[model samples]
Target: MAKVSFDGTSGFEVPRHVAIIMDGNGRWAAARGLPRGEGHRRGVEALRRTVRAAGEIGIGILTIFAFSSENWSRPQSEIRDLLGLLRLFIRKDLSELNRNNVRVRVIGDRETLSDDVRGLLEEAEELTRNNSGMTLVVAFNYGARQEIARAAQRIAEAVVSRGLSPADISADKLSEFMDAPDLPDPDLIIRTSGEQRLSNFLLWQSAYSELVFMPTFWPDFDRTTLEQAISEYARRERRFGGLAAAGT
Candidate 1:
């Protein structure tokens, strides 16, 4: 509920939590006559930049759509490349992230992942569990619809085991069952590559988030791109289904 201010003459009101759908990797690679894997590699570099920029700009939480459940439907070779990149990123950047006090939180179905992959994710969280700086949420193998269904299943199990009445279920109760209920909902959701839709990222958590679509590809995203999105978010009024303020 607290507001973050940009320390500049722009007087931008930065969002406390920002979620990004990193898209256009393949297109970027294609445009450059390079393999898609190369684009993904560059995308990772952009991620490193964005993370540093977010921390420097006073962002409390940064959630990224790293890999989605539907991404498995892509070519097996591409899937392998993505998983490899994830492994490389964690192995190479985990130490630096911890030293900088960045907390890593992963949300998704871990049961389906290989033991090694799962272990790495667990290690990332454990190593940074006590960090006090910005929290980075990686949505790997995640889908909002599946997350909601999983929460519903847990609620049902609790009702059966604890003899709780079904009437006690509410929106807030359902939210508490989500993967990372302690994390606040996103205040702004940005999709790069000119995408206009969420594409299954943070459906429930983005109910009132300001959406910004950028023509820039994921590999081209930088601090300026992030600032542009934040500036646009500041220019708008979030009514949340109510009337705007009396003054303009």
Candidate 2:
């Protein structure tokens, strides 16, 4: 992969892909004595800011955890509100994203979504498929366990149908069956709201990702916060179970 130059910074390694677990919307809203819906609304604004910031910082790909499969277990009213916000974001922001040359890619279980929502997700991807700028991957209705299970099922079917031999299955081969197989694994995974757990997001892709847990809530995250996270990532040495480089 070609290294992205952060302008005038000599020998600084930046993460090519960054994934975020946006959390604590409800807590933020509760602290302010406002409804959770308000927190989600503000969270959307934070996302907009972060997207532009990621592009400005030369991040090649930004993947955000928008909705998890377990999120469906939440209250129906809250789910409705969350879905409404998603609709609003796409309908109102798609044009701007396209104009800015940002490509939108959605990964998840699409067959389980409502028809209209599924169409909108596809539209977002199709409209920006040719964009050359930073790619924004939205993980909606996604769960890593479910994704892996689906991949396994596909591999099994291929073997049973004589499309693939069982002996040929390998980790790399199985990865091709995953959602958004073209996307590179995230180099850094940041979880806001001081969360210390993965919470079933990007289990496979985050195998070697540097994890950062920020105390700021999702609604409070901004460009500076993102930069700080990146700086933290840069300070650490990733060994991938091997010895670190000579210098610190």
Candidate that would win on TM-score:
1
Q: For every model shown, what is its TM-score relative to the native structure?
A: 0.96, 0.95
CA deviation > 4 Å runs, candidate 2: 1-11
- The C-alpha RMSD in Å for every predicted model, in order, reads 1.7, 2.1
Model 1 regions lying over 4 Å from their true place: 1-10
**TM accuracy, model 2:** 0.95
Can you write out model 1's per-residue Cα lDDT over 1-248, one digit (the tens) per residue? 33455455635557899999999999999999999999999999999999999998889999999999999999999999999999999999999999999999999999899999999999999999999999999999999999999999999999999886889999999998999999999999999998799988889998999999999999999998998899888888999888889844
User: Which tens-of-lDDT digit does each residue in 1-248 have in candidate 2?
Assistant: 23433444654666999999999999999999999999999999999999998988888999999999999999998999999999999999999999999999999899999999999999999999999999999999999999999999988988889679887999999999999899899999999999799999999989999999999999999988997898788889899888878743
